[model samples]
Target: MPVARLSPATLSAVRVTLPGLGVIAVAVALSLAVNRLVPAVSPLTGAVVLGVLVGNLPVLPESARPGLKWATRRFLRAGVVLLGVQLSVAQVLQLGGGMLLVVLVTVLTTFFGTVLLGRLLGLPRGLTLMVSTGFSICGASAVAAVEGIVEREESEVATAVGLVTLFGSVSMLVLPLLADGVELGMWAGASVHEVAQVVAAASPAGAAAVAAAVVVKLSRVVLLAPLAAGLSIAERRRRPAAEGGRPPLIPLFVLGFLAMVVVRSTELFPEAWVPMTKDVTGLLLAGALFGLGSGVRVRSLAKTGPKALVLGLGSTLLVTLVAYTGVRLLG
Candidate 1:
């Protein structure tokens, strides 16, 4: 019998590079193809789907694990940093008081309601909270920020994030078509989860609708602090003993995001650099989404199945109806 020989260093390098290379290849190809053909669906969404599908296909060889981890982590971090470039304080404020109130109500109501729904459905508490926060706040960023306080298992976070990304992407693709028929601009504004998703969904609705959606999404983002504070207090009370016998402090990222907003409003950054910052932020968000998808297990996600899909679709419709009716009545 021939003796099998393995060099640990060589094996490790192979393990890391293989999965990373496969995922990147799939993601890039899918993104490019979808962008070229559909032109309507966002490339980021395609990248995410590709990542999740490829990542969960099988366990990587031991030798390739490190390289895969490093690539995914770097991608996520770059996406987050790029996200920051989009937060110019001045534009957010320009949405004014009425738009601000709408955002606050939508975020708070959806978040708390989702939590209740999740609990009633008997979902894991941490997963429930993660899904609720991700849906009601800034999507993946909200999940990441809350993860520190919640101490949820990484698997739970991964599953919740995957669900959010799936539903958010679906909304981006479907909502604009619905808007064309319904002419419900305000409804679309409140229903979509992320700024990018909102913009993508509303693109077909003409400039007026797209502008309205952006304002609505940004307005919701502004409420991140109060929402986080409320959740922190609620979580603390719910798990006083587990959380070091004290309330958790609100995440610092919210503050940093707001601080950046304030600084930008002060006219500190050159105007010429603003667009570049926005582009960078977008790319970073795409990378983070890619990273998030990479960590998810498609088989496990399939287990969530019809129930998850139903919940997401139902909640979205409920929010859309409420927002549309409320806005119409109030306006």
Candidate 2:
């Protein structure tokens, strides 16, 4: 008789991770269903919303934590890296020196300006950094990437995610209603929090607008690696040896992101691979967001309500103004 069975340790590991993984899997499925039924809502955003519902209503169980951690850490990083597959250096370069400058100035001003504003408003640096990153760069995905660098609380992550959802949706709807609205796809692509939001905001402008917005948005995305690396360096220095050992100069995941960008730029991958890669990246990110959302404590999030609302509003306004200005002048 020949038999094959799992090792004891392997089975133990599965036992530890499975419950959380199960929950994440189910959340993702439901999120996807919601998105399918409501085409206006992105599955990734739906994942976080559903996760918040699950965590808050039923209360996420302790036993599910290990898998949640695994999902957020591994899946999130992989998704971020794969995001590069959608971009090429040439796409960004097409924006020309002026439009590229608009993208750069907008990102830098929004990020730093939000940080300074948060400090003045007495918000925690972690919350500010995450929120600013979300507003400045790529939304929830950027917040997730920087979470590892700054080691923020899950509640803070939820709050940052909340603001991204709130203002991003507003921008998505409002941007298309403006004068030269569709043309402002460059502005939407520059300022809106999520890529999905940018696409939604710009898509009505036609394929050309969508194309312009995406290229500009992806340029902002390319900033993630450097911003994260710089933050990681500062964070590693700030912590004492007693608190933790020094981390890599740049997080490995960030490096992986850069590598993917290079792969895409070189045209090493077939054009046909683009859609498949985007789908995979979207799924992975949605899963990670669900995991993060499961950790939220709403009451804690409320503690920062007034200040957070103000900060979120301000950040949104700041980015919008900057992006609008940049695009008007340069674009």
**Candidate 1 lDDT, tens digit per residue, 1-331?**
9999889997877765777656565566667687679754455656666657656776434554455566655554444444554556666677666656666677777787877887677667777777777787777666655655564654565666666667777777776665562244555667776666777777777788777777666666666666667777777777758547454565455555666566666777677886887766555445545555666775666666665555566556556655665565552
Q: Which stretches of candidate 2 lie above 4 Å from their native place?
A: 1-6, 59-62
| Tens-place lDDT digits, model 2, residues 1-331 | 9799999999999999999998888888898898889765777778887887788886678899898887787999999899889888888898899989998999999999999999999998899999999899999889888887886777898888888988999998888888344457788889989988898889888888888888889999999989999988988898877886666689999999999889988857888999999999888999999888877878887899899989999999999999998888888
lDDT of 2 at 233: 94
In candidate 1, residue 253 scores what lDDT? 54
Whole-model Cα lDDT per candidate?
A: 0.64, 0.87
Query: Candidate 1 — which pairs collide?
Result: 11-63, 15-63, 15-64, 15-65, 16-63, 16-64, 16-65, 16-67, 79-284, 82-281
Please give each candidate's TM-score: 0.75, 0.94
Minimal lDDT window, size 10, model 2: 176-185
In model 2, the clashing pairs are: none
